[model samples]
Target: MSGPGTAGAVETEPASARAGLGGRYARLWTASTLSAVGDGMSLTAAPLLAYTLTDDPRLVAGVTTALTLPYVLFGLPAGVLVDRVDLLRAMRGIDLFRGLLLLTLAVAVALDRGNLLVLYICFFLIGTCETFFRNASQVIVPSVVPRKLLVDANGRLLAAQTAGNEFVGPLLGSVLFAIAAAVPFGIDAASFLLSALLLSSLLGVRSAKPSTRRTGGPSTSERPADLPAAPGSGVDSAGPVSATRPGLLADMTTGARWLLRDRLLRGLALAAGGINLVLTAGLAVMVVHAHTVLGLGSIGYGLLLACQAVGAVFAARLAPRLVRRLGDEQALVCVAATMAAANVAVWLVPVGTGVGLALAAAACAGVTWDVVVVALRQTRIPRPLQGRVNSVYRLVAWGAMPVGAALGGLLSTAFGTPSVFAAGAVLMTMIAACLAEGARRRWISDPR
Candidate 1:
């Protein structure tokens, strides 16, 4: 009883067939899940550790800013490095580096000698490592799974991240912190180590290459041996073809050109950037609202956040079918609109212990939109340039986060907590309108 476009009806190569439950993809998925868990632990633990050390809200905020700065500064270079290296090796290196860094933080905490300067430095280094790791992982996905299963693979990754990192990671971090601040750091370090081991085992698996060859020349199989290599040639004689070693600026420009030239991708990127700005602003003010406005303690705030994660986990599972039924472009627009509507509800709602309910609604909308946007980008962007395109997309979208955080803080201080949510609602509404207009033009209709 397969439908016209059902998973069962998709054609694929024998070796590239679906890796169902308990298969190669599952193993990779596990490694990704473990890595996400470690990431979640660090995300919560790092800010908490900073707060415990200085008891200063500004310092806690500083930790986030310092970490994110690397993405703005080194994102393009990181993309280049990811494209150049063996993706699995790069990820393994990131895990090992992150493990050692977390261990150092754990030791600092255990010794009761944790300093703000040291914490900031460590956070910055880890963030830089994460930038590379993220780019590499995006590159690795297509290599390990068939083209037909890309959406499913991405869905699994998103689900694992939402479940393990978002839900369990924070809850675990909170519990471990109650026991001893050092414990969460130690567990995070272990998870990273295990992730490295799993990634190392994935060596010798070659991913699918891009359809177009590099600018320098084609492979011997593509061109006759009697034909001379292109001018200023540097071929590996035995390896596959590669693009010329373009400069960082050129590489970045290449990515930008591709995105701008494609109307759908450009519109998608802009919409994502706009929505992320608002979402980050809402998140920045949420903790303060829970604590001061709603009379909830830090633990309650954490629990509410965890509930948000749970909502996201369910939403990710539901997004694909929703998109297939509604059509990707229309579904994305609806998701964006839903997020806007949810934010408005949160803004208008009364502050009470019922904050969890409001937060859950917002999370559901956010997560649905996030899943749709990610899948859309993965399908539309070229495989070889995924790293660069992802970097560019992140550069524009994530670049708004810091501004949002700062603005949220200022708006909360000026008007109050509700103002932050109101502003987020407005921005999200604008994003929804933009997406809807794009869909009407059929700009985001196809897999291109």
Candidate 2:
């Protein structure tokens, strides 16, 4: 099955139709990278600050929990909102809102007023906006690029994201945090403001408007008065829903029903959820692990993260080719197996260099998995349902992060830091087995 807007068209288009990702994609890519860098800085700084306030592993991990909790709480509603609104406008507004929030946090920190409560509130709000922002971004990509180039486009985007989010951003953030503890948040605030300015230029290229034609069958009236009007029609395109429009509950049900009826997507979401639950568990206590077992400070920890980012960039560069050769189903299985092995290696080799190498391998597997799954999801989902379905899909895929982080904190508090990696290896091995069995049973399809 192909996306209603892209896949069918890709099948008929000539080889000559292959073109560069174009100017619009470039702008979106830049804006997304800028935002990712800011997010990375904030993420690195937040945990470091938490570590300063308290030595409790659970408290440190709570920062991560706050940053991901909103996905589980509001993923469905965010999907509905993303589907109903103009994506560019929504993203611009979200960037500005998040910038203001970070600015406030920066001031709070500068004034020596930072506390665990304040940090949690700030992270939770940022995470809330992230749910909508990430969904809207994914929904807009297919509109900007050809479906046949989905793998290439997604791989480049993932690479840029890794460089900014993990490589440059975290390294810069840790250095700044060591200076004053407030500089990183201030810098992140500025990045968001700049990103919003970049997005303001793409409003006229193509309006990411939802399909106004009602589902169920063809109809003479494709444009409904209750739906948002197309861009530049001299109407408020993303105004509040009219009473005649489908209610929020109805919209949510539509997306959920579509996802549930698709066996491959449903199974993928469940497997991803399980994998994330364990992966996040290991990551949540990484700060504690670095301090207690590895004897590393902030700079060393940032370098450790940089190792993973470098591996991710390398893998993202190769993901498109790998997918083309191995096919999507096989590539996914390979990623799962690789990740399981990497986690076990970390458990076995607890030294700084050995663990960093293992982490790099895990990051490589992670980016490969992301590029394949995101492209598959984008190409397979319908255009109008992109936001809703992607959100519903990620509701399981990403919503497990906070829960896993919390579990990690509890386990670390009881069993010690090294145990987190050992436990993650076991869980990931189980995920790999399930994925292999699912492939054999034909629950997953190759999107070649």
Candidate 3:
């Protein structure tokens, strides 16, 4: 399957027909966007349902924790599994599974069986599936699109997610929840099913050649052919074979090893993880601020969140251009700095409706940081290791999210919302400063 000019070839249709974008890439883009919108709806609706049912702030935080904790626990293993599986099949399976899970929740809600335990269990399952789907999608992108188009592809994906899922999805979900909690869940379930169908059609479309070299070992082509295969048989004699078996723990360890060995990846993961922690903490507190401090009802809070999503949308749109002009490393530094500045700015705002504007600014910064960083990572990481690296990164970086949520709740309860915002701002600034200095020293380079 390896041939001259084949390595970087794009699988999509003609560029002219795509309005200057690459061919079938547009279809994939649309599918991803719709999927994101659906995901966004669930992000909003799930928490709202949890809160409505329990009316306990701790329980609400716990629900949020349940959703994110998988990144810490299962991300590495999921990455390993992605590498072993058929990328398309894995993605489609995850989407279908997620859809079914959401449908079950919808049924539960309709049947008045939506208890805390059920919600928590569903949340964990959904999070685990998401880890696999996300890793597979990132790994598969370079195969479907030309290497030169990677930044653009990543930017489009981010924009769709920010606009549809984070912005529009949440807003619509909130509205639908107002009408009926089950409605948003139904929409979420449908979106995942649709995404699964689209992904399934893409199966066997592009198959990546197996890496001849193992980690820290010589190329596979260079090795003696008669050497026996590894014990688990992830690869088949017929050709490059997909991992069809379940070995989540071993897979996770593989991801962790990759992260520990790569210096650039390690730094990037640390920066991302730190920022994620702060972001989650801030969000946890914001819910309370919107409700109690601002005296906004659920609808008002949803609108404020929608505004934040709008800011993120704008950031996502602008990130690719900034990266092109400044180069990936510089762009990442700038985005991180911007996020830190925005965080500090939010802290300075007077309490109440003014805080909404502050959060909007912060949201823009956060989105820019997110898009650029993800694009850079996707570009820099080796294709075969993308799943493992992403998983490990998520495990370490996102591990703090649950803790952040808990802390945010505690601080809000003790020192109040202002203190939470202040603490988050300080932490973000420190992280930005560290990353900026590291980037300046050329510790991280643009893979392009």
Candidate 1 structure, TM-score to reference:
0.78
Candidate 2 Cα outliers beyond 4 Å, as residue runs: 1-27, 140-157, 201-245, 320-330, 375-384, 445-448
Clashing residue pairs, backbone N/CA/C < 3 A, model 1 = none
TM-score of 3: 0.76
Q: Which ranges of candidate 1 are over 4 A from the true structure?
A: 1-27, 53-58, 141-155, 204-245, 324-330, 348-353, 370-385, 436-448
Candidate 3 residues lying further than 4 Å off, grouped into runs, are 1-16, 19-27, 142-154, 204-258, 261-265, 317-353, 370-387, 432-448
> lDDT tens string, model 3, 132-205?
67766665666567666776665555555556765677789888888888888888889888878877666646
Error of 1 at 111 (Å): 2.8
Highest lDDT among the candidates is held by which one? 2
User: Between candidates 1 and 2, which one is better according to TM-score?
Assistant: 2
Question: How far is 6's C-alpha from truth in model 1 (Å)?
Answer: 20
lDDT of 2: 0.73
Of models 2 and 3, which has the larger TM-score?
A: 2
lDDT string, candidate 1, 1-448, tens digits: 0000112111122222345423556657777777777677667667667656653344555666667667777877776665445567777788888888888888988999778898889887877887777766755766666656776776566566666666667778776776788888888888888888887777656632222434322333433342222211233445455445455567678787887787766776777677767776767566566656676654565676677776665565576677778887788778777777767766787565455676666666665665566677778776556656767887877677666766766777778778888888888878888777778877665434
Candidate 3 has an lDDT of: 0.66
The Cα RMSD in angstroms, rounded to one decimal, for candidate 1 relative to the true structure is 7.3
Clashes of 2: 0
